[model samples]
Target: MADILSILLSDSFWAAALRIATPLIFGVLGALLCERSGVLNLGIEGIFVAGAMTGWLAVWMGAPLWLGVLAAALAGAGFGLIHAILTVPLGLSQHVSGLGVTMLATSVAYFTYRTALPDVTSPPRITPFQPLDIPLLSDLPFVGPVLFQQTALTWLALGCVFLVWYVLNRMSLGVALRAVGDNPDAVDAQGLSVYGLRIGAVMAGSALMALGGAFLTMSAFDAFFFGMVNGRGWICIALVIFASWRPGKALLGALLFGAFDAFQVRLQTEVGAMVPGQVFLMAPYILSIIALVVAARGADYPRALLTPWFKGQR
Candidate 1:
Protein backbone atom coordinates (compact mmCIF):
# COMPACT_ATOMS: atom_id res chain seq x y z
CA MET A 1 0.00 0.00 0.00
CA ALA A 2 2.79 2.41 0.82
CA ASP A 3 4.55 1.68 -2.46
CA ILE A 4 1.32 2.14 -4.42
CA LEU A 5 0.71 5.49 -2.74
CA SER A 6 4.24 6.59 -3.46
CA ILE A 7 3.87 5.63 -7.12
CA LEU A 8 0.62 7.56 -7.40
CA LEU A 9 2.22 10.64 -5.88
CA SER A 10 5.27 10.57 -8.13
CA ASP A 11 5.75 12.81 -11.18
CA SER A 12 6.31 9.79 -13.42
CA PHE A 13 2.75 8.58 -13.03
CA TRP A 14 1.29 11.95 -13.99
CA ALA A 15 3.65 12.26 -16.92
CA ALA A 16 2.66 8.82 -18.15
CA ALA A 17 -0.99 9.80 -17.79
CA LEU A 18 -0.48 12.80 -20.09
CA ARG A 19 1.33 10.65 -22.62
CA ILE A 20 -1.42 8.07 -22.65
CA ALA A 21 -4.10 10.76 -22.95
CA THR A 22 -2.59 12.66 -25.86
CA PRO A 23 -3.89 10.42 -28.66
CA LEU A 24 -7.24 10.20 -26.95
CA ILE A 25 -7.55 14.00 -26.86
CA PHE A 26 -7.12 14.09 -30.62
CA GLY A 27 -9.68 11.35 -31.18
CA VAL A 28 -12.24 12.73 -28.74
CA LEU A 29 -12.04 16.21 -30.24
CA GLY A 30 -12.56 14.72 -33.70
CA ALA A 31 -15.50 12.63 -32.54
CA LEU A 32 -16.96 15.62 -30.74
CA LEU A 33 -16.94 17.68 -33.94
CA CYS A 34 -18.72 15.01 -36.00
CA GLU A 35 -21.32 14.24 -33.36
CA ARG A 36 -21.89 17.94 -32.78
CA SER A 37 -22.72 18.28 -36.44
CA GLY A 38 -25.22 15.41 -36.20
CA VAL A 39 -23.00 12.62 -37.49
CA LEU A 40 -22.10 9.71 -35.26
CA ASN A 41 -18.91 8.44 -36.86
CA LEU A 42 -18.06 4.91 -35.88
CA GLY A 43 -15.54 4.99 -38.74
CA ILE A 44 -13.02 6.53 -36.32
CA GLU A 45 -11.45 3.13 -35.61
CA GLY A 46 -10.64 2.43 -39.24
CA ILE A 47 -9.58 5.99 -39.91
CA PHE A 48 -7.13 5.68 -37.03
CA VAL A 49 -5.58 2.55 -38.50
CA ALA A 50 -5.42 4.07 -41.95
CA GLY A 51 -3.77 7.19 -40.61
CA ALA A 52 -1.17 5.18 -38.72
CA MET A 53 -0.31 3.16 -41.82
CA THR A 54 -0.26 6.07 -44.23
CA GLY A 55 1.74 8.34 -41.95
CA TRP A 56 4.34 5.69 -41.21
CA LEU A 57 4.61 4.74 -44.85
CA ALA A 58 5.23 8.36 -45.79
CA VAL A 59 7.98 8.69 -43.21
CA TRP A 60 9.46 5.38 -44.30
CA MET A 61 9.48 6.60 -47.89
CA GLY A 62 11.69 9.59 -46.96
CA ALA A 63 9.10 12.33 -46.50
CA PRO A 64 9.49 14.75 -43.60
CA LEU A 65 7.71 13.85 -40.37
CA TRP A 66 5.24 16.74 -40.72
CA LEU A 67 4.42 15.61 -44.24
CA GLY A 68 3.58 12.19 -42.88
CA VAL A 69 1.13 13.86 -40.53
CA LEU A 70 -0.39 15.74 -43.45
CA ALA A 71 -0.77 12.56 -45.47
CA ALA A 72 -2.61 10.96 -42.58
CA ALA A 73 -4.93 13.94 -42.21
CA LEU A 74 -5.69 13.97 -45.93
CA ALA A 75 -6.38 10.25 -45.99
CA GLY A 76 -8.73 10.70 -43.08
CA ALA A 77 -10.48 13.56 -44.86
CA GLY A 78 -10.91 11.35 -47.91
CA PHE A 79 -12.58 8.68 -45.79
CA GLY A 80 -14.81 11.31 -44.27
CA LEU A 81 -15.89 12.35 -47.74
CA ILE A 82 -16.89 8.78 -48.46
CA HIS A 83 -18.97 8.76 -45.30
CA ALA A 84 -20.56 12.08 -46.18
CA ILE A 85 -21.49 10.81 -49.62
CA LEU A 86 -23.12 7.74 -48.17
CA THR A 87 -24.88 9.45 -45.28
CA VAL A 88 -25.51 12.96 -46.57
CA PRO A 89 -26.66 13.11 -50.21
CA LEU A 90 -27.42 9.39 -50.46
CA GLY A 91 -29.25 9.59 -47.12
CA LEU A 92 -28.12 6.21 -45.90
CA SER A 93 -28.27 5.22 -42.26
CA GLN A 94 -25.43 6.92 -40.38
CA HIS A 95 -24.83 3.84 -38.24
CA VAL A 96 -24.50 1.53 -41.25
CA SER A 97 -22.40 4.01 -43.21
CA GLY A 98 -20.07 4.62 -40.29
CA LEU A 99 -19.51 0.92 -39.58
CA GLY A 100 -19.01 0.29 -43.30
CA VAL A 101 -16.42 3.03 -43.43
CA THR A 102 -14.56 1.43 -40.54
CA MET A 103 -14.47 -1.95 -42.31
CA LEU A 104 -13.45 -0.48 -45.63
CA ALA A 105 -10.67 1.70 -44.21
CA THR A 106 -9.15 -1.05 -42.06
CA SER A 107 -9.27 -3.62 -44.87
CA VAL A 108 -7.66 -1.23 -47.32
CA ALA A 109 -4.89 -0.45 -44.86
CA TYR A 110 -4.24 -4.15 -44.22
CA PHE A 111 -4.13 -4.94 -47.94
CA THR A 112 -1.78 -2.08 -48.68
CA TYR A 113 0.52 -3.06 -45.83
CA ARG A 114 0.73 -6.66 -46.98
CA THR A 115 1.27 -5.75 -50.61
CA ALA A 116 4.01 -3.28 -49.75
CA LEU A 117 5.93 -5.50 -47.37
CA PRO A 118 4.91 -9.10 -47.76
CA ASP A 119 8.15 -10.92 -46.88
CA VAL A 120 9.53 -8.76 -44.10
CA THR A 121 9.97 -10.66 -40.84
CA SER A 122 10.55 -7.48 -38.90
CA PRO A 123 8.23 -4.45 -39.09
CA PRO A 124 9.66 -1.40 -40.85
CA ARG A 125 10.12 1.58 -38.59
CA ILE A 126 10.79 5.30 -38.96
CA THR A 127 12.45 7.89 -36.75
CA PRO A 128 9.58 9.00 -34.57
CA PHE A 129 9.33 12.50 -33.13
CA GLN A 130 11.03 12.85 -29.77
CA PRO A 131 9.58 14.91 -26.95
CA LEU A 132 10.28 18.63 -27.27
CA ASP A 133 10.62 19.97 -23.77
CA ILE A 134 9.26 23.49 -23.45
CA PRO A 135 12.05 25.85 -22.45
CA LEU A 136 11.05 27.62 -19.26
CA LEU A 137 7.92 25.62 -18.51
CA SER A 138 9.79 22.33 -18.52
CA ASP A 139 11.97 23.75 -15.78
CA LEU A 140 9.04 24.21 -13.42
CA PRO A 141 8.68 21.83 -10.54
CA PHE A 142 6.19 18.97 -10.96
CA VAL A 143 3.97 20.77 -13.51
CA GLY A 144 6.69 21.14 -16.13
CA PRO A 145 7.67 17.51 -16.30
CA VAL A 146 4.06 16.36 -16.42
CA LEU A 147 2.76 18.79 -19.06
CA PHE A 148 5.64 20.34 -20.94
CA GLN A 149 7.65 17.21 -21.65
CA GLN A 150 5.51 15.90 -24.48
CA THR A 151 5.81 15.61 -28.24
CA ALA A 152 4.85 18.46 -30.57
CA LEU A 153 1.64 16.68 -31.50
CA THR A 154 0.63 16.39 -27.86
CA TRP A 155 1.02 20.14 -27.45
CA LEU A 156 -1.05 20.65 -30.58
CA ALA A 157 -3.70 18.36 -29.14
CA LEU A 158 -3.89 20.58 -26.08
CA GLY A 159 -4.17 23.69 -28.25
CA CYS A 160 -6.93 22.04 -30.26
CA VAL A 161 -9.08 21.67 -27.18
CA PHE A 162 -9.20 25.44 -26.85
CA LEU A 163 -9.45 25.97 -30.61
CA VAL A 164 -12.42 23.66 -30.87
CA TRP A 165 -14.19 25.33 -27.98
CA TYR A 166 -13.62 28.78 -29.45
CA VAL A 167 -14.91 27.77 -32.84
CA LEU A 168 -17.95 25.94 -31.49
CA ASN A 169 -19.07 28.65 -29.09
CA ARG A 170 -17.83 31.94 -30.49
CA MET A 171 -17.94 31.56 -34.25
CA SER A 172 -20.81 32.05 -36.68
CA LEU A 173 -19.89 28.93 -38.59
CA GLY A 174 -20.24 27.01 -35.36
CA VAL A 175 -23.72 28.37 -34.84
CA ALA A 176 -24.77 27.17 -38.27
CA LEU A 177 -23.19 23.81 -37.56
CA ARG A 178 -25.05 23.39 -34.28
CA ALA A 179 -28.25 24.54 -35.94
CA VAL A 180 -27.83 22.04 -38.74
CA GLY A 181 -27.38 19.23 -36.27
CA ASP A 182 -30.34 20.22 -34.15
CA ASN A 183 -32.65 21.04 -37.02
CA PRO A 184 -31.41 20.86 -40.58
CA ASP A 185 -34.74 21.94 -41.98
CA ALA A 186 -34.54 25.14 -39.98
CA VAL A 187 -30.98 25.75 -41.09
CA ASP A 188 -31.99 25.22 -44.70
CA ALA A 189 -34.97 27.53 -44.28
CA GLN A 190 -32.55 30.27 -43.21
CA GLY A 191 -30.73 30.03 -46.59
CA LEU A 192 -27.89 27.77 -45.46
CA SER A 193 -26.97 24.51 -47.15
CA VAL A 194 -27.41 21.63 -44.73
CA TYR A 195 -25.55 19.12 -46.88
CA GLY A 196 -22.60 21.44 -47.28
CA LEU A 197 -22.34 22.13 -43.56
CA ARG A 198 -22.60 18.52 -42.51
CA ILE A 199 -20.11 17.36 -45.14
CA GLY A 200 -17.64 20.02 -44.15
CA ALA A 201 -17.97 19.18 -40.51
CA VAL A 202 -17.49 15.46 -41.09
CA MET A 203 -14.48 15.95 -43.35
CA ALA A 204 -12.81 18.42 -41.02
CA GLY A 205 -13.57 16.28 -38.03
CA SER A 206 -12.21 13.20 -39.78
CA ALA A 207 -8.98 14.96 -40.67
CA LEU A 208 -8.40 15.58 -36.98
CA MET A 209 -9.28 11.97 -36.28
CA ALA A 210 -6.65 10.85 -38.75
CA LEU A 211 -4.12 13.14 -37.08
CA GLY A 212 -4.81 11.26 -33.87
CA GLY A 213 -3.94 8.01 -35.59
CA ALA A 214 -0.88 9.53 -37.20
CA PHE A 215 0.31 10.56 -33.75
CA LEU A 216 0.34 6.89 -32.81
CA THR A 217 2.84 5.98 -35.53
CA MET A 218 4.74 9.22 -35.86
CA SER A 219 5.23 10.01 -32.19
CA ALA A 220 3.81 7.40 -29.82
CA PHE A 221 5.55 4.55 -31.63
CA ASP A 222 8.14 4.44 -34.39
CA ALA A 223 6.57 1.43 -36.08
CA PHE A 224 3.08 0.60 -37.17
CA PHE A 225 1.77 -2.86 -36.34
CA PHE A 226 -1.53 -4.63 -36.71
CA GLY A 227 -3.95 -3.77 -33.89
CA MET A 228 -1.67 -1.03 -32.66
CA VAL A 229 -4.65 1.25 -32.24
CA ASN A 230 -6.14 -1.37 -29.89
CA GLY A 231 -9.58 0.22 -29.66
CA ARG A 232 -8.54 3.78 -28.73
CA GLY A 233 -10.95 4.97 -31.42
CA TRP A 234 -13.84 3.21 -29.73
CA ILE A 235 -12.78 4.69 -26.42
CA CYS A 236 -13.03 8.13 -28.02
CA ILE A 237 -16.65 7.36 -28.82
CA ALA A 238 -17.37 6.60 -25.19
CA LEU A 239 -15.42 9.71 -24.23
CA VAL A 240 -17.70 11.87 -26.36
CA ILE A 241 -20.66 10.64 -24.38
CA PHE A 242 -18.79 10.83 -21.12
CA ALA A 243 -17.93 14.43 -21.86
CA SER A 244 -21.53 15.19 -22.75
CA TRP A 245 -20.22 16.49 -26.10
CA ARG A 246 -18.18 19.31 -24.57
CA PRO A 247 -14.54 19.93 -25.55
CA GLY A 248 -13.33 20.98 -22.10
CA LYS A 249 -15.07 18.08 -20.48
CA ALA A 250 -13.63 15.77 -23.13
CA LEU A 251 -10.10 16.86 -22.15
CA LEU A 252 -10.80 16.10 -18.51
CA GLY A 253 -12.34 12.77 -19.43
CA ALA A 254 -9.38 11.80 -21.58
CA LEU A 255 -7.00 12.70 -18.76
CA LEU A 256 -9.00 10.61 -16.33
CA PHE A 257 -8.88 7.62 -18.66
CA GLY A 258 -5.18 8.20 -19.20
CA ALA A 259 -4.60 8.21 -15.45
CA PHE A 260 -6.36 4.88 -15.16
CA ASP A 261 -4.21 3.45 -17.94
CA ALA A 262 -1.03 4.77 -16.34
CA PHE A 263 -2.05 3.43 -12.94
CA GLN A 264 -2.87 0.09 -14.51
CA VAL A 265 0.64 -0.14 -15.90
CA ARG A 266 2.07 0.73 -12.51
CA LEU A 267 -0.11 -1.84 -10.83
CA GLN A 268 1.00 -4.51 -13.28
CA THR A 269 4.62 -3.79 -12.47
CA GLU A 270 4.33 -3.19 -8.74
CA VAL A 271 1.54 -5.53 -7.67
CA GLY A 272 1.64 -8.18 -10.31
CA ALA A 273 1.82 -11.04 -7.84
CA MET A 274 -1.20 -9.96 -5.81
CA VAL A 275 -3.51 -8.88 -8.64
CA PRO A 276 -4.11 -10.61 -11.95
CA GLY A 277 -2.68 -8.89 -15.02
CA GLN A 278 -6.04 -8.98 -16.74
CA VAL A 279 -7.61 -6.85 -14.05
CA PHE A 280 -5.08 -4.10 -14.61
CA LEU A 281 -5.51 -4.34 -18.37
CA MET A 282 -9.26 -4.06 -18.14
CA ALA A 283 -9.37 -1.23 -15.62
CA PRO A 284 -9.52 1.64 -18.12
CA TYR A 285 -12.23 0.04 -20.25
CA ILE A 286 -14.35 -0.88 -17.24
CA LEU A 287 -14.12 2.71 -16.00
CA SER A 288 -15.17 3.95 -19.42
CA ILE A 289 -18.29 1.80 -19.26
CA ILE A 290 -19.13 3.20 -15.87
CA ALA A 291 -18.59 6.75 -17.12
CA LEU A 292 -20.91 6.15 -20.05
CA VAL A 293 -23.69 4.92 -17.79
CA VAL A 294 -23.23 7.81 -15.40
CA ALA A 295 -23.10 10.50 -18.07
CA ALA A 296 -26.12 9.24 -20.00
CA ARG A 297 -28.56 10.94 -17.70
CA GLY A 298 -29.82 14.28 -19.06
CA ALA A 299 -27.49 13.95 -22.01
CA ASP A 300 -28.61 16.26 -24.78
CA TYR A 301 -27.78 14.70 -28.12
CA PRO A 302 -28.31 16.49 -31.40
CA ARG A 303 -31.94 16.24 -32.46
CA ALA A 304 -31.20 15.20 -36.04
CA LEU A 305 -28.32 12.90 -35.14
CA LEU A 306 -29.44 9.74 -36.94
CA THR A 307 -32.06 11.30 -39.16
CA PRO A 308 -31.18 12.02 -42.77
CA TRP A 309 -32.23 15.42 -44.01
CA PHE A 310 -34.21 15.79 -47.22
CA LYS A 311 -34.95 19.17 -48.83
CA GLY A 312 -38.72 19.07 -48.62
CA GLN A 313 -39.45 16.00 -46.52
CA ARG A 314 -41.59 16.63 -43.45
Candidate 2:
Protein backbone atom coordinates (compact mmCIF):
# COMPACT_ATOMS: atom_id res chain seq x y z
CA MET A 1 0.00 0.00 0.00
CA ALA A 2 2.81 2.38 0.87
CA ASP A 3 4.57 1.70 -2.39
CA ILE A 4 1.37 2.23 -4.35
CA LEU A 5 0.72 5.47 -2.52
CA SER A 6 4.26 6.63 -3.21
CA ILE A 7 3.87 5.84 -6.87
CA LEU A 8 0.63 7.79 -7.08
CA LEU A 9 1.94 10.70 -5.06
CA SER A 10 5.06 11.22 -7.09
CA ASP A 11 4.79 13.91 -9.71
CA SER A 12 6.81 11.92 -12.21
CA PHE A 13 4.15 9.23 -12.43
CA TRP A 14 1.46 11.68 -13.43
CA ALA A 15 3.80 13.35 -15.90
CA ALA A 16 4.58 10.01 -17.51
CA ALA A 17 0.87 9.22 -17.63
CA LEU A 18 0.18 12.44 -19.48
CA ARG A 19 3.00 11.73 -21.91
CA ILE A 20 1.67 8.27 -22.57
CA ALA A 21 -1.81 9.67 -23.18
CA THR A 22 -0.70 12.16 -25.83
CA PRO A 23 -0.78 9.88 -28.88
CA LEU A 24 -4.08 8.34 -27.82
CA ILE A 25 -5.56 11.81 -27.57
CA PHE A 26 -4.79 12.42 -31.21
CA GLY A 27 -5.94 8.98 -32.29
CA VAL A 28 -9.24 8.92 -30.39
CA LEU A 29 -10.10 12.39 -31.61
CA GLY A 30 -9.48 11.28 -35.17
CA ALA A 31 -11.60 8.19 -34.76
CA LEU A 32 -14.35 10.21 -33.10
CA LEU A 33 -14.45 12.65 -35.99
CA CYS A 34 -14.71 9.88 -38.55
CA GLU A 35 -17.45 8.09 -36.63
CA ARG A 36 -19.30 11.33 -36.08
CA SER A 37 -19.56 11.54 -39.86
CA GLY A 38 -20.71 7.91 -40.13
CA VAL A 39 -17.40 6.36 -41.13
CA LEU A 40 -15.29 3.71 -39.45
CA ASN A 41 -11.63 3.87 -40.43
CA LEU A 42 -10.19 0.46 -39.70
CA GLY A 43 -7.14 1.56 -41.68
CA ILE A 44 -5.84 3.49 -38.67
CA GLU A 45 -3.40 0.76 -37.70
CA GLY A 46 -1.55 0.84 -41.00
CA ILE A 47 -1.77 4.61 -41.20
CA PHE A 48 0.01 4.75 -37.86
CA VAL A 49 2.89 2.71 -39.21
CA ALA A 50 3.06 4.84 -42.34
CA GLY A 51 3.03 8.01 -40.29
CA ALA A 52 5.77 6.85 -37.93
CA MET A 53 7.97 5.70 -40.81
CA THR A 54 7.39 8.68 -43.09
CA GLY A 55 7.65 11.33 -40.40
CA TRP A 56 10.90 9.89 -39.11
CA LEU A 57 12.19 9.48 -42.65
CA ALA A 58 11.39 13.09 -43.47
CA VAL A 59 13.34 14.33 -40.46
CA TRP A 60 16.25 12.00 -41.29
CA MET A 61 16.22 13.48 -44.77
CA GLY A 62 16.52 16.98 -43.24
CA ALA A 63 13.03 18.42 -43.36
CA PRO A 64 11.89 20.52 -40.41
CA LEU A 65 10.08 18.57 -37.70
CA TRP A 66 6.74 20.34 -38.19
CA LEU A 67 7.11 19.84 -41.91
CA GLY A 68 7.61 16.14 -41.29
CA VAL A 69 4.33 16.16 -39.38
CA LEU A 70 2.73 17.73 -42.42
CA ALA A 71 4.21 15.02 -44.64
CA ALA A 72 2.70 12.39 -42.37
CA ALA A 73 -0.72 14.09 -42.38
CA LEU A 74 -0.71 14.30 -46.16
CA ALA A 75 0.20 10.65 -46.46
CA GLY A 76 -2.69 9.75 -44.16
CA ALA A 77 -5.06 11.99 -46.13
CA GLY A 78 -4.06 10.28 -49.37
CA PHE A 79 -4.96 6.87 -47.99
CA GLY A 80 -8.17 8.28 -46.54
CA LEU A 81 -9.10 9.62 -49.96
CA ILE A 82 -8.82 6.13 -51.36
CA HIS A 83 -11.09 4.75 -48.66
CA ALA A 84 -13.52 7.62 -49.09
CA ILE A 85 -13.76 7.18 -52.87
CA LEU A 86 -14.37 3.45 -52.67
CA THR A 87 -16.94 3.56 -49.90
CA VAL A 88 -18.70 6.87 -50.50
CA PRO A 89 -19.23 7.03 -54.26
CA LEU A 90 -18.61 3.44 -55.39
CA GLY A 91 -20.49 2.26 -52.31
CA LEU A 92 -18.19 -0.64 -51.70
CA SER A 93 -17.96 -2.39 -48.35
CA GLN A 94 -16.46 0.05 -45.86
CA HIS A 95 -14.96 -2.73 -43.82
CA VAL A 96 -13.22 -4.37 -46.73
CA SER A 97 -11.95 -1.09 -48.13
CA GLY A 98 -10.67 -0.02 -44.73
CA LEU A 99 -8.89 -3.30 -44.12
CA GLY A 100 -7.40 -3.18 -47.62
CA VAL A 101 -6.08 0.29 -46.95
CA THR A 102 -4.48 -0.93 -43.74
CA MET A 103 -2.65 -3.78 -45.47
CA LEU A 104 -1.62 -1.56 -48.35
CA ALA A 105 -0.33 1.25 -46.17
CA THR A 106 1.58 -1.08 -43.87
CA SER A 107 3.19 -2.91 -46.78
CA VAL A 108 4.14 0.31 -48.54
CA ALA A 109 5.69 1.74 -45.39
CA TYR A 110 7.77 -1.37 -44.71
CA PHE A 111 8.90 -1.65 -48.32
CA THR A 112 9.85 2.01 -48.38
CA TYR A 113 11.88 1.60 -45.19
CA ARG A 114 13.81 -1.39 -46.55
CA THR A 115 14.40 0.30 -49.90
CA ALA A 116 15.57 3.52 -48.26
CA LEU A 117 17.94 1.88 -45.82
CA PRO A 118 18.90 -1.40 -47.41
CA ASP A 119 22.37 -1.59 -45.89
CA VAL A 120 21.65 -0.32 -42.39
CA THR A 121 21.47 -2.90 -39.63
CA SER A 122 20.29 -0.48 -36.98
CA PRO A 123 17.60 2.12 -37.43
CA PRO A 124 19.05 5.64 -37.43
CA ARG A 125 17.88 8.30 -35.01
CA ILE A 126 17.07 11.99 -35.24
CA THR A 127 16.76 14.77 -32.64
CA PRO A 128 13.41 14.41 -30.88
CA PHE A 129 11.22 17.04 -29.28
CA GLN A 130 12.33 18.17 -25.84
CA PRO A 131 10.05 19.04 -22.95
CA LEU A 132 9.41 22.68 -22.20
CA ASP A 133 10.97 24.34 -19.13
CA ILE A 134 8.70 27.14 -18.11
CA PRO A 135 10.62 29.30 -15.70
CA LEU A 136 8.02 29.85 -12.98
CA LEU A 137 5.49 27.16 -13.71
CA SER A 138 8.00 24.43 -14.28
CA ASP A 139 9.45 25.21 -10.87
CA LEU A 140 6.19 24.72 -9.03
CA PRO A 141 6.26 21.97 -6.41
CA PHE A 142 3.89 19.53 -8.10
CA VAL A 143 1.91 21.18 -10.86
CA GLY A 144 5.09 22.22 -12.68
CA PRO A 145 6.30 18.87 -13.93
CA VAL A 146 2.78 17.52 -14.37
CA LEU A 147 1.61 20.08 -16.92
CA PHE A 148 4.12 22.71 -17.95
CA GLN A 149 6.98 20.41 -18.82
CA GLN A 150 5.52 18.50 -21.75
CA THR A 151 6.87 18.79 -25.29
CA ALA A 152 5.25 21.00 -27.91
CA LEU A 153 3.46 18.09 -29.53
CA THR A 154 1.95 17.09 -26.20
CA TRP A 155 0.62 20.60 -25.81
CA LEU A 156 -0.70 20.42 -29.33
CA ALA A 157 -2.57 17.22 -28.51
CA LEU A 158 -4.23 18.85 -25.51
CA GLY A 159 -5.10 21.93 -27.54
CA CYS A 160 -6.66 19.63 -30.12
CA VAL A 161 -9.02 18.22 -27.48
CA PHE A 162 -10.53 21.64 -26.93
CA LEU A 163 -10.48 22.37 -30.64
CA VAL A 164 -12.23 19.15 -31.55
CA TRP A 165 -14.78 19.59 -28.78
CA TYR A 166 -15.54 23.18 -29.78
CA VAL A 167 -15.87 22.35 -33.42
CA LEU A 168 -18.08 19.34 -32.80
CA ASN A 169 -20.34 21.03 -30.25
CA ARG A 170 -20.40 24.71 -31.14
CA MET A 171 -20.17 25.08 -34.87
CA SER A 172 -22.51 24.82 -37.86
CA LEU A 173 -20.15 22.48 -39.67
CA GLY A 174 -20.22 20.19 -36.68
CA VAL A 175 -24.02 20.21 -36.70
CA ALA A 176 -24.07 19.13 -40.32
CA LEU A 177 -21.40 16.56 -39.73
CA ARG A 178 -23.33 15.08 -36.82
CA ALA A 179 -26.61 15.25 -38.71
CA VAL A 180 -25.22 13.46 -41.74
CA GLY A 181 -23.95 10.68 -39.53
CA ASP A 182 -27.32 10.19 -37.85
CA ASN A 183 -29.63 10.60 -40.86
CA PRO A 184 -28.04 11.03 -44.25
CA ASP A 185 -31.40 11.09 -46.00
CA ALA A 186 -32.50 14.10 -43.98
CA VAL A 187 -29.23 15.88 -44.72
CA ASP A 188 -29.54 15.04 -48.40
CA ALA A 189 -33.15 16.28 -48.37
CA GLN A 190 -31.83 19.63 -47.18
CA GLY A 191 -29.64 19.75 -50.34
CA LEU A 192 -26.33 19.13 -48.56
CA SER A 193 -23.74 16.97 -50.30
CA VAL A 194 -23.55 13.90 -48.12
CA TYR A 195 -20.68 12.43 -50.12
CA GLY A 196 -18.60 15.57 -49.81
CA LEU A 197 -19.17 15.89 -46.04
CA ARG A 198 -18.39 12.25 -45.36
CA ILE A 199 -15.31 12.33 -47.57
CA GLY A 200 -13.97 15.50 -45.97
CA ALA A 201 -14.51 14.17 -42.43
CA VAL A 202 -12.70 10.92 -43.19
CA MET A 203 -9.78 12.77 -44.73
CA ALA A 204 -9.45 15.28 -41.92
CA GLY A 205 -9.92 12.65 -39.23
CA SER A 206 -7.27 10.47 -40.88
CA ALA A 207 -4.89 13.38 -40.93
CA LEU A 208 -5.24 13.69 -37.16
CA MET A 209 -4.63 9.97 -36.78
CA ALA A 210 -1.33 10.34 -38.61
CA LEU A 211 -0.28 13.07 -36.25
CA GLY A 212 -0.55 10.56 -33.41
CA GLY A 213 1.90 8.33 -35.28
CA ALA A 214 4.18 11.27 -35.88
CA PHE A 215 4.14 11.87 -32.13
CA LEU A 216 5.42 8.35 -31.60
CA THR A 217 8.51 8.85 -33.80
CA MET A 218 9.13 12.55 -33.21
CA SER A 219 8.28 13.16 -29.56
CA ALA A 220 8.12 9.77 -27.78
CA PHE A 221 11.25 8.40 -29.41
CA ASP A 222 14.01 9.54 -31.72
CA ALA A 223 13.82 6.66 -34.20
CA PHE A 224 11.17 4.47 -35.70
CA PHE A 225 10.97 0.69 -35.26
CA PHE A 226 8.73 -1.88 -36.87
CA GLY A 227 5.83 -2.77 -34.56
CA MET A 228 6.43 0.32 -32.45
CA VAL A 229 2.84 1.37 -33.05
CA ASN A 230 1.67 -2.00 -31.79
CA GLY A 231 -2.12 -1.74 -31.30
CA ARG A 232 -2.55 1.86 -30.20
CA GLY A 233 -4.71 2.51 -33.23
CA TRP A 234 -7.15 -0.24 -32.32
CA ILE A 235 -7.22 0.96 -28.75
CA CYS A 236 -8.31 4.37 -30.01
CA ILE A 237 -11.16 2.76 -31.90
CA ALA A 238 -12.46 1.14 -28.72
CA LEU A 239 -11.90 4.38 -26.88
CA VAL A 240 -14.26 6.19 -29.27
CA ILE A 241 -17.00 3.76 -28.35
CA PHE A 242 -16.12 4.09 -24.68
CA ALA A 243 -16.39 7.84 -24.98
CA SER A 244 -19.81 7.61 -26.57
CA TRP A 245 -18.43 9.74 -29.43
CA ARG A 246 -17.70 12.75 -27.24
CA PRO A 247 -14.26 14.41 -27.38
CA GLY A 248 -14.14 15.23 -23.66
CA LYS A 249 -14.87 11.67 -22.65
CA ALA A 250 -12.35 10.49 -25.21
CA LEU A 251 -9.66 12.48 -23.44
CA LEU A 252 -10.70 11.07 -20.12
CA GLY A 253 -10.61 7.53 -21.45
CA ALA A 254 -7.16 8.01 -22.93
CA LEU A 255 -5.87 9.50 -19.69
CA LEU A 256 -7.36 6.68 -17.67
CA PHE A 257 -5.61 4.13 -19.85
CA GLY A 258 -2.41 6.09 -19.68
CA ALA A 259 -2.53 6.12 -15.91
CA PHE A 260 -3.09 2.39 -15.89
CA ASP A 261 -0.16 1.87 -18.24
CA ALA A 262 2.22 4.04 -16.25
CA PHE A 263 1.19 2.41 -13.01
CA GLN A 264 1.91 -1.04 -14.37
CA VAL A 265 5.39 -0.02 -15.41
CA ARG A 266 6.17 1.21 -11.95
CA LEU A 267 4.52 -1.76 -10.33
CA GLN A 268 6.57 -4.08 -12.47
CA THR A 269 9.76 -2.54 -11.14
CA GLU A 270 8.54 -2.59 -7.56
CA VAL A 271 7.69 -6.29 -7.69
CA GLY A 272 11.19 -7.04 -9.06
CA ALA A 273 10.37 -9.98 -11.41
CA MET A 274 8.37 -12.00 -8.91
CA VAL A 275 5.51 -11.55 -11.37
CA PRO A 276 6.02 -12.29 -15.03
CA GLY A 277 6.66 -9.14 -17.03
CA GLN A 278 3.95 -10.12 -19.46
CA VAL A 279 1.38 -9.72 -16.73
CA PHE A 280 2.35 -6.11 -16.25
CA LEU A 281 2.35 -5.50 -19.97
CA MET A 282 -1.17 -6.82 -20.34
CA ALA A 283 -2.59 -5.07 -17.31
CA PRO A 284 -3.42 -1.81 -19.03
CA TYR A 285 -5.08 -3.49 -21.99
CA ILE A 286 -7.15 -5.70 -19.73
CA LEU A 287 -8.27 -2.73 -17.70
CA SER A 288 -9.10 -0.80 -20.84
CA ILE A 289 -11.22 -3.70 -22.05
CA ILE A 290 -13.14 -3.73 -18.83
CA ALA A 291 -13.73 0.00 -19.06
CA LEU A 292 -14.80 -0.29 -22.67
CA VAL A 293 -17.31 -3.00 -21.85
CA VAL A 294 -18.74 -0.89 -19.11
CA ALA A 295 -19.06 2.35 -21.05
CA ALA A 296 -20.10 0.77 -24.34
CA ARG A 297 -23.27 -0.53 -22.74
CA GLY A 298 -24.86 2.88 -23.09
CA ALA A 299 -22.92 4.29 -26.00
CA ASP A 300 -24.92 6.35 -28.45
CA TYR A 301 -23.46 5.55 -31.83
CA PRO A 302 -24.02 7.39 -35.08
CA ARG A 303 -26.95 5.68 -36.79
CA ALA A 304 -25.63 5.77 -40.34
CA LEU A 305 -22.28 4.33 -39.38
CA LEU A 306 -21.66 1.41 -41.89
CA THR A 307 -24.65 2.19 -44.08
CA PRO A 308 -23.78 3.44 -47.55
CA TRP A 309 -25.81 6.13 -49.27
CA PHE A 310 -26.04 6.71 -53.01
CA LYS A 311 -26.98 9.83 -54.87
CA GLY A 312 -30.75 10.12 -55.62
CA GLN A 313 -31.53 7.02 -53.61
CA ARG A 314 -34.98 7.24 -52.04
lDDT against the true structure, each candidate: 0.90, 0.90
Cα RMSD, each candidate: 1.2, 1.0
Give the runs in model 2 whose Cα sits over 4 Å from its true position.
none
Q: For residues 1-314, write the lDDT of model 1, one tens digit per residue.
A: 89889888988899999889988998999999998889889899999999999999999989999999999999999999999889988889998899999999999988998899999878988999888887999999988889888889899899999999999999999999899889898899999999999999999889889988999999989988999988889899989998988899999999999988998898788769998788877787788888888888978898889888887787
lDDT of the structure predicted as candidate 1: 0.90
Candidate 2 lDDT for residue 4? 100
Model 2 RMSD in Å is 1.0
Residue lDDT tens for model 2, 216-287:
999999998989998898889888999899999999989988888998899889995698888887776677
Model 2: pairs clashing at backbone N, Cα or C within 3 Å: none
TM-score of each: 0.97, 0.98
Candidate 1 worst ten-residue window by lDDT = 280-289
